[model samples]
Target: MLAHSEWKAAGEQLENQPVAGEQAALNQYAHLVRRVVAHMRSQVGVVADRDDLQQIGMMALLKSIRRYGRSLDEQFESYAFKSIRGAMLDEFRRLDWRSRQSRKEAHDFRDAVRELRRELGREPRDAEICVALKISERQLLNMRYLEQAEVVESFEMLLEQQTHFVDSNEDIEQLEVRQLMTQTLALLPERHRILLQLYYTHELNMKEIALTLGLTESRVCQLHKQSLQLLTEKLKG
Candidate 1:
């Protein structure tokens, strides 16, 4: 076992002799690898392999060691901890990016909502949205149609995007945002609410929703888009 005393000595040596410090840190490989595995398991759940996490974590750990400085305001462990976790998170994002929908269309939809709110001081009707965006109702509907087809994320996934203000730790901001969204969701029509529940809460695909709701897949898709459009405007208010 590498002692805390040894860790301190190696950290101090790193100031004068970086190679020696790096070798010393290697003596404590088990400790660093364990910390990395803990971070991976938290974000990715239990299926993650120890060897894979260890390999990624070691790369991050080495980078941290190389960049760490005695002149910094924080301790070596604190700095290295962030580096290791950030590395793992980047890998996780890369893997998940395949299915990750573009937040752009969703964001643009919200922006249009906000503009209507500012101009009208209330939830603008679809016609009003058409005027505010300077497009005809059919064009606006087309925009929504395209957005709906492009949207692969469910309501729950959207919620996840919103609440990610929570960061690495829980805070009052996360709680407040969640509470507000809960209220906003409740205000939606019963049928619209159900659509959100099936897609986001139940994590169902469009085909599954069509089967369960006894509607055609195209109808379900339209409903999904219409519901989000309504909710986005209402939330803006």
Candidate 2:
């Protein structure tokens, strides 16, 4: 979170020479850049280059301030946070962080689980999947985590698109979509709403959200999926 004084200083600095002000703003918000990069790295695992991600985040932050052209406040912070994260996600998409081998392993893991479920005539247990796949429970958990991360990432991409739509244009169709999304969100369960807010608005990752809500990260992931499903179904209705 940015302090009031920091925001004030950043706003004052940005009123000066453009290049120097941008640098000053970046320096003032360097801590925020680091925090966002750290959170992204945790989500992305070791495959992400921290230095590159931080550079992306810093650039996004600078762009955000210039684009906003408003007083530095809580609204600016929220806007900048989303901008920074969206830029990082764009970089990740460009990099294709998941290796071919990792994708193949994930595909195999899913196929094995599906086969076991069909053969058993029920959803296979974690222990069963581990045995059938010749993987340890921890490995199975990691696979599941990757799957969950994919779902979360997909939802975040949708959100990033929506944010762009809102920012770039406020056409009638977009307004209607925004209204419907608001209504759909309002209909969600209280816990689901909070989880969505924490993740999307507050920009906390699943692990941090798990600690805050006193639930396991896996449960948070499931609830996240469930919440998105409910929103989708409601919007369709």
In candidate 2, where is summed lDDT lowest over 10 consecutive residues? 164-173
Residue 192, candidate 1: alpha-carbon lDDT: 90
Give each model's whole-structure lDDT.
Answer: 0.61, 0.70
Error of 1 at 90 (Å): 11
Report the C-alpha lDDT of model 2 over 1-237, residue by residue, as the tens digit.
889999989887665434877777778777777767745533455346788787778878888878877777776776677678778888877777677886687688778878999999987776677788898766765676666556556665565445445345524444555565677789888988888778655778767888999986655665776787676555556
Please, what is the TM-score per model? 0.35, 0.67
Q: Model 1: clashing residue pairs?
A: none
* Candidate 1, 60-143: lDDT as tens digits: 777667675443344666556656756775665555532333346546776887877888887667667767778876565544
TM-score of 2: 0.67
What is the Cα-based lDDT of residue 81 in candidate 1?
62
